[model samples]
Target: MELLGLDSFNLVVRHGGFGAASRACGQPKATLSRRVRDLEESLGVRLIERGGRSLRLTDEGAVLHAQTASPVEAINDALNDIRAGLGRPSGRLRISAPILFANTALGVLAAKFIEAYPDVILEISTEDRFVDLAADDLDVVIRANPRPDDTLVGRCFMRNELVLVAPPGLSRPARVEGSAERLTFPAVMRMGTGDDDVWTIIDADDGLPRRYHPKAVLRLSSPLTIRNAVLAGAGAALVPRTVVAEDLASGQLISWGTASGPEIEVWVLHASRRLVSPKVTAFVNFVCDHFNAPTR
Candidate 1:
């Protein structure tokens, strides 16, 4: 339990500054700073150094961090093992997911998981930004681009692919004679979500990079708006395969490419905790299995 405070300290150190750490932790900047200071007071050592906006671990703090990290993680793992032996998991499991994945994959998987573990109450949060598992108490997070931190364990569960899609009847813009290889079309950019619509494609014929940078006609944060714009034939768009799977299957959307598509990876990450807990472990296992299923 004492390691929990140490874990929080670890986050601030890793993120480099309190503002960034607070954003990751989903806590007010002042509150996170206070908590860190309180933890340092209890430890009787100054663990972090403040240089205006910059942060660095003290010499003693770095040594203590390195020493305690692995053992704290192992202790948590051991506790989780003890809980799982009791059988059915019963507790609250909080999960965060990307907007596209949440709209597409989570629906069926979540339903089945909840049904199998009735005692587990699921709290799901759909956000485009990276979720803070430690402060938010999120059991797991489904992130598009997985970034592992010192205080978190990440597991890649499923594979995804990015495909350029447009409305079924939408006509490809007429390519200029010399610019046929490179075309410019109006596109809806993903704004404020830490992503852009730059399409990345690889040619299987040759291991060459064929990048497509569509001219963004509009920038938006809503995936639904992007989909609607694509459907309306406003312009071409690159969306995740999972999000537009049914559309692709039903011919409502067409995948535009001469070669293969971009590689997409799905990862589930969890913060280092005192224990994984039965509910979190069960839920993680369920998501891993369900997404990797042959039919899914």
Candidate 2:
């Protein structure tokens, strides 16, 4: 069987259809269809079952794809490595990130990375949902730990401290005499999938952890939304320090100290640590190094 035909078939499966594969590979749709058909004929078995507006792989096609996909990817990756070793990083790099990060430092870092490696085409997706790297054909993802999949490798590049904050004009009750007298205020919180309504706080003086079930005035999913609500004097919110640092500096928000919350550890995640492509490696290293460097 011709390797070219097999490669064409693989592209069709990867991109979901001949039209998509044609666009991705910069080939004509009819040409790609003919190549895949040639591959099926040479194997003496039907590979793909074409139906109304959808494509399905026959059993033979499934087996062939399962066998050939990895080898084809490895070969492409090897070529990319050679190109990269010759001095420039090139090729498409697909990344996934949360909306908050994508709107913040990630936007700046991505711009700098693209500027540094002009040949690399960067595609970024922003959402709150967890992405399956292999299934989604993603090269890298930036997210908070604990990672969803154990098979994936993650590099922790930054820590996001969670802090309780309120608007500068919001009134705070006078500090009472006892430990139990620590004030509880209405809070805007991110509603978890579970039914728990508890918030944790660390005692500023004794350094012990405390749990407070504050009355939730509003529950929302987005950190940026929660931050805005707090800034509007709706209620206090436990949020990542990065989200509110500018507000705190500008005196729009006041910090109520560290919250008893999970460490918002940020990680750069990928499917495999071994045999990573040059595009993925360059991006991961650039982000890690940028965050690791000491500030002025």
Candidate 3:
């Protein structure tokens, strides 16, 4: 089949309909429809099922789409890279990151990046769930975990540690020597459904590990929310230090300094198969430099 026909078909499938694809590609809807029909006729198979108010791909169409999508994307990326190499980086870069990180330092960093690379369009998605980068057509995904995924090639820019913190001026019982005295304050937990209701911490004096189950006063799924609750004197919570570094610095919250939780590893992941575009490489390097600097 011709490359033009295949490109039109890909656009239609990606945008879900001819009307949307036409608007996106700056082509007439009739022209796009004709291209796809010509492609199907040349292939001798029904690619799409047309009906009232909706479009569905046939079995053959799905197979062809799955086979061609990656190659087409790679070709497009390569062409874009060539054009960008000739001049300044000028293309759309789509990224996905967690909501907490997006709301924190990532936003500032993104703004700085945009200011530095005025020609590139930066699109960011702040969602808690993991997004399939290739399937979703995203260029990069920033995530926090203990290790990078073996499937993707990326860089770990920072190490995030969870800390136990409380609102400033909250009274607490003093630690007794050689005693595992449990604190009686209510706990604010950042937990999802089916998560265990316990926290592990190490004794600062003895360096021994122990698990403490505080009375659950507020349970939330977002670290930012838990930090805000802790700042409001709701209860002590275990949260990533990045989420509350300013609060801890300003004495809005008090760090318990209990190094019991695991450190969260932050990574920027890209697809392993596609060639790393100039825009993607620039972003990865900028973020790494920003976080890895000595002052940070």
Candidate 4:
């Protein structure tokens, strides 16, 4: 249980400098330096390589850090699991997610989590851009098709299926075929990442994927704007199942095609650490359990 020293090392890597790490960790620079030195002496291998004013991890340090992070995080998760088993979740949980998901899904889950753990502080940020969880002081990031680094941890939270939806005024094409199916009205595209145009549908009977190419009319990264546009009678759109759930339930929008579509997996991600304290662990467990609930 080299918990304390491993945490300091992880902080130094996250902050990129001793001074910044000291400030973030609320420790004096001298004290942090001594702690790291003691850790190096205890391990008999240099963890941080001096790079003028900045510090870089030695090859051995990188491997050691990576190997130790998950266990540290698991320790933290274990503590939280114990606390949750006893019916108490008390800690701070920081989260970041896409604007659409943050507003629609996480908002509800966060509220429920806070209610369950009244002593826990749930900080959430809604940004479409990606943030480094370790560096940005973030505990978890919910992302679609998240590709975590070797030093990070990822947990799939939910599965997302993309579907084409349009306003009531849009006309249904007489013949819908393969990826080249031509629709009469222009399509509103969620222009995030480069794969917006590559719309796919899954064959319900065979459970195989089929692609579709729509006539592009509007291209924007904001899913909210696309939803609003579709609601205001712009055109058809390929959007997340969660994003359109309420509107579809309310009959504001309708599913466009018969074939099913591609599935985008959503994940909860966090930095790899040697020791996950009670706070971080509790949050991860709570989030996973919350999202994995029967209603979810």
Off by over 4 Å in 2: 1-3, 14-16, 28-31, 41-44, 51-56, 59-71, 81-87, 148-150, 173-175, 179-182, 193-196, 203-211, 293-296
Clashes in model 1: which pairs? none
lDDT of 2 by residue, 181-262 (tens): 4366778888762334555667545675656555678899999999988888898888899999999899899876687656
Number of clashes found in candidate 1 = 0
Q: Candidate 1 residues 1-296, lDDT tens each?
A: 34667766766765778888888768788877777788888878888887765787899888876666544544554565567666557755778988778877788888999899987778899888866665454668888767657777756787766667777676655534445355556766567532334455553234544556678777767666787787777876766666677877888888775325436677777766446667767877787777673322
Error of 3 at 99 (Å): 0.6
Q: TM-score winner among the candidates?
A: 3
CA lDDT, every prediction?
Answer: 0.69, 0.79, 0.79, 0.71
TM-score of 2: 0.84
Q: Write the per-residue lDDT of candidate 4 for residues 1-296, one digit (tens) a residue.
A: 25677877776776788899988879998877887778888989999987676777899888876666545545555677576764455556678888777777777787777776687788888887868764456667778887647766867767777777877667855545555553355778756434335555553335555555667678887877888888988788877777888898898998764345346887776767534555555666776787783333
Weakest lDDT window of 10 consecutive positions for candidate 1: 192-201
Model 2, residue 20: C-alpha shift (Å): 4.7
TM per candidate comes to 0.62, 0.84, 0.86, 0.63
Q: On a 0 to 1 TM-score scale, where does candidate 4 land against the true structure?
A: 0.63
**Superposition error at 191 for model 2 (Å):** 2.0
Candidate 1 segments whose C-alpha is farther than 4 A from its true place: 1-85, 173-180, 192-213, 258-262, 293-296
Worst 10 residues of 2 by lDDT: 192-201
Which residue pairs show backbone clashes in model 4?
69-273, 69-274, 72-274, 72-275, 72-276, 76-276, 201-261, 202-260, 202-261
